[model samples]
Target: MKVYILWHVHHVAVDEVGNVAHFENGEFSARENLGDDVKLLGVYSTPDRVERRISVARTLPGFRDEPDCFWSAEVEVDEDDWASGYVTE
Candidate 1:
């Protein structure tokens, strides 16, 4: 299964440390649970620009939430072979 953090109109909360941890010697701190580096792919908007903007205020683990039309998930996903680079002539 793939995991991703999606938000709309606002940034997700993150701790002072980036998404990593170092367990050396005998000290450790909280590490980011979301694995892998995430990057912004693109931005999407409702077809009707005049539509109201909805924001994701909070989130819970293992819980699924509905995203507003204006909200977009900024994560990567596997591209279908045909969609990526399959050709038939």
Candidate 2:
């Protein structure tokens, strides 16, 4: 059994860190756009189980400052379990 996973990310970088350095506001918008596009593709066998995720990260201005922030999401499905409605090629 084989499982298919789709992952997407969109980000707008900023120069400095401050009240909006993390851009939580833009994060929602970016997620909405990406989610809408993913839904439009209609490529998943199980729409109900279709997984979506958003991630945001930041680094120092000049040198690598060891990840300042990170976010992610994950979904697990049993490919062998047809009950999960896996698509077959």
Please give the clash total of every predicted structure, in order. 0, 0
| Model 2: per-residue Cα lDDT at residue 80 | 36
Please give the TM-score that candidate 1 achieves against the real structure.
Answer: 0.16
Candidate 1 local accuracy as lDDT? Answer: 0.32
Write model 2 residue lDDT over 1-89, tens digit each, in one string.
22334333233433255222333645632234323121221233443333331112123331122232233333355533356676667
lDDT of 1 at 32: 32
TM-score of each: 0.16, 0.21
| Residue 82 lDDT (model 2) | 56
Candidate 1 lDDT tens digits, 1-89 = 22243332222334457523333245432233433222332334432321222322224221213232123333345533355676567
Worst 10 residues of 2 by lDDT: 54-63
Model 2, stretches more than 4 Å misplaced?
1-12, 15-20, 26-66, 78-89
**Candidate lDDT values, in order:** 0.32, 0.32
Error of 2 at 35 (Å): 21
